[model samples]
Target: MKAPPFEYHRPSSLDEALGLLAELDEAKILAGGQSLLPLMSLRLGRPEHVVDIGDLGILDSLVVEPDGSVRVGALVTHRQVETSAEVAAHAPLLHAAAPMIGHRPIRTRGTVCGSIAHADPAAEMPAVALACNAAITAVSSRAAREIAAADFFEGYLQTVIEPDEIVTRVQFGPWPRHRRGAVVEQSRRSGDYAIIGLACWLDIEDNTITDAALSFFGVSDTPIRVAEAEDVLRGQAPTQSTFSAAGRTAAGVLRPTSDIHASANYRRHLAAVLTERGLAKATAESGETR
Candidate 1:
C-alpha cells in the first residue's frame, strides 16, 4: 500500500515547520516517521500536507538539562535515547523501557516525542512518562506551553495537543541513584505489543522503601498509575505477602475493558501478578529488599 498523494514540505527551520503546521489543513508533522509513515502507507492517515521536520537541527538534541532532567528533542531517535548515558543515569525507567518498543531498526528511526504524541495506550513510553512525571513541551506558530505527562494523554491515541501544535521536547526528571527501576511487559513474543506491561521504581533508604511508583499499560485507555498500590507499599517492608496484597488492591481499583487481545478479567489478573513481580524485581534490584 502507498500513502495518498500529498504536498510535502521539508522545512529546514523550526519556525518554518511551525508555520506549515499552523497554516495547512490536515497537515501532519513528521519526526522520525516510524509511527506516522506506517499508518500513512496503509492509508489510515491521509494528510493533505506532510511537514517534514527531520532537518530542523534545533529539534535533534538529546541532552541532560541544567535542572537535572533529561530532555529529548523531537528528532532524537529511540536508538540514541536507548544508548544515552544521561538517560541511563537520570531516567533509568525510560532507559529500560526503550528497548521494549518494536525492534532495533524501528528504534533506530523512532522518536520519543513522536511516540508520546501518538499516545498509543499499549505503548511503553507513555507508561514510563507517567511513572516518571515527565514534562512535555508543545509549540505552535502562535504559542508554546509545557504539559505534564499526566495531563498530556487524554485517551487511546488521543492527546490534549491541538492539531496546530507540535511536541517540541520531552523532559524527564532525574531519578535518584538509590532508586531502582524495572519494566515488566507480558507480550506473546519479543518486539510484540505487550498484552499488559508494568513500569515501576522503588526508592529505598536505610533498607526501607521510602517511595514507589507503579504505572501500567495495555489494560486501559491510558497509562494507569496504581496509586492505591503505591500507597500500600510505601511504608511496608517488602515481603511476598505485602506485595501480594498491594497487587490485589491494584487489580480491584482498575477498570479495564475487554479487547481482542485480552479479556478484562485476564488483564486484571496480569495487573495483579505483574504488580507483585515488578515491585519485587525493582526492590531487589535496589539491593534493599529485606
Candidate 2:
C-alpha cells in the first residue's frame, strides 16, 4: 500500500509549523511517524498536507524541572524516554510503561506526544498521564494553553485539541520521595497492544496509605479512573481484603465491549484481577505486605 498524494512541509520553528497548520486544510502534523505513517500507508489517513515537525528544535526537549516536574516534548522519541535517567528517577511509572509500547524499533521513532495525541484507549501513556495528573501544553497561531490530562482525552482516539492546535509537551510533577508506582499490562504477546492495563501509585505513611491513584486502559472507551477504588484504599491499611474490594469497585464501573482478542466479560474479569496485582505491587513497593 502507498500513502495518498499529499504535499509535505518540514517546518523549522514552532511558529512556522503553526502557520502552516493554520493555512493548510486537512493538514496532519507528523511527529515520529510511527502511527501516522502506518495509517497513511494504509489509506486510513489521507491528509491534504503533511507538516513534519520532526526537525523542530523547540519540540525536542526532555528535561526534569527544578520543581520536580518532568517536561517531555513532542519530538522526544520513546527510546530517548526509555533511557532517560531524569524520567526514570522522577517518573518510574512512565519509564516502566514505555517498554510496553510496541517494539524496540517502533519505540525508537514513536514520540510520546504522538501516542498521547492518538489517544488510543489501549495505549499506556495516556493512562500514566491521567494517573500522574499531567498537564498537556497545546499551541496554535491564536493562543497557547494547558489542558489537564483528566480533561484532555475526550474518548477513543479523540481529544479536545482543535485542528490548528498542536500538542507541545506534557508536564507531570511533585515526584514524592515515598512514591510507589507500578505499570501492569497484559497482552496476547510481548509488545502487542494490551488487552487490559493498569497504571497505579500509592503514597504510604506510618504504615497506612496516605494516597492512591489507579487508572485502567483497554477496557473502556477511554481510560477508566474509579475514584471509589482510590477512596477505599486511602487512609486504610494495605490488605488483600481492601484491594479486593477496590478491584470489585473498579469492575463495576467498567463497560467494556466484546472483541476478538477477548470477550467483554473476560476484560471485566482482568480489570479486577489486574487491579489486585497492581495494588499488591504498589503496597509492596511502599514497604508493606498484603
Candidate 3:
C-alpha cells in the first residue's frame, strides 16, 4: 500500500513547526513516523500535509533535571529511553516497560511522543506515564502548557492535543527509592499488541505499603489508573491475600471489548492474572515480604 499524496514540510524549529500546523488544519506532525506512516500507508490517515519535526534540535535530547525528574524530548526514541542511565536510575518503571514496547527495530524508530500521541490503549508508555504521574508539555504558536498524564489521554487513539499543538517534552518524576515496580502483559506473540497489560509501582515504609499506583492497558478504551486496586494496597501489609484482593478489584473495573486478538472475557482473565503477577513482583521488589 502507498500513502495518499500529501505536501511535506520539514521544519527546522519548533516555532516553524507550530506555524505549519496552524496554517494547515489537515496537516499531521511526523515524529518518528513509526505509527503515522503505517496508518498513512494503509490509507487510514489521509492528511493534506505532513510536517516533519526531525530537524528540530531541541526535541531530540534527554535532559535530567536538578530536581531529579527526567525530561524526555518528543523525538527521543524508545531505544534511547531503554538505554539511558539517567532514565534507568530515576525512572526504572519507564525503563522496565521500554523493552516490552515492541521489537528492537520498532523501538529504534518509535519516538516516545509519537507513542503517547497515538495513545494506543495497549502500549506500555501510557501506562508507565499514568503509573509515574508524568507530565506532558505541549506547544503551539501562541503558547505552551503542561498536562498531567491523568488528563492527557482522552480516549482510544485520542488525546487532549489541539489541532495545532505539538508535544515538546515529557517530564517524569523520580521513582521512589526502594520502591517496587513491575510490568506484565499478554500478547498472542512476541512484539504483538497486548491483550491485557498491567504496570504497578509500590512504596513500602515500615513494612507497610505507603503508596501504590496501578495502571492498565488493553482492557479499556484508554490507559486506566486502577484506583480501587491502589486503594486496596495502600496502608496494607503486602501479603498474598492482599495482592489477590487487589487483583480482583482491578479486574472488576475492566470493560474490555472482544476483538480479533482476544475476547473480552479472555482479556478480563488476563487482566486479573497480570494484575496479581505485577502486584506480587512489585511487593517482592519493595522488600515488603521476607
The prediction achieving the highest lDDT against the true structure is 2
Compute the lDDT of residue 248 as modeled in candidate 1. 98
lDDT of 1 by residue, 1-290 (tens): 89899999998888988888888899988888988999999999998999998888999889887766899899988899889877777777888899999999999999889999998989999888899889999999889999999898899899999988989999998667678879998998899889999999877767677898889999889987988999988877777887898899989988888878889999899999998898878766643211
lDDT of 1: 0.87
TM-scores of all candidate predictions against the true structure: 0.95, 0.96, 0.96
Compared to the true structure, candidate 3 yields what TM-score?
0.96
Tell me how far the alpha carbon of residue 206 in candidate 3 is from the true structure, in angstroms, after superposition: 1.0
Model 1 residue 69 CA deviation (Å) reads: 1.5
Clashing pairs in 2: none
Better of 2 and 3 by lDDT: 2
lDDT of each candidate versus the true structure: 0.87, 0.88, 0.87
lDDT of 3 by residue, 1-290 (tens): 89999999999888889999998979898988889999999999999999999999999989888877889999999999999877777777888888998899999999987898889989988888888879999999988999999999999899999999999989998666758888888988988888889888888778798889889988888899988888999999888888888888877887789999989888877877887898787666633211
Candidate 2, residue 281: Cα displacement in angstroms equals 1.6
lDDT of 2 by residue, 36-84 (tens): 9999999999999999998899889999888878999999988998998
> In model 3, what lDDT does residue 63 have?
84
Model 2 alpha-carbon drift over 4 Å, by segment: 286-290
Q: Kindly provide the TM-score of model 2 when superposed on the true structure, using C-alpha atoms.
A: 0.96
Tell me which residue pairs clash in candidate 1.
Answer: none
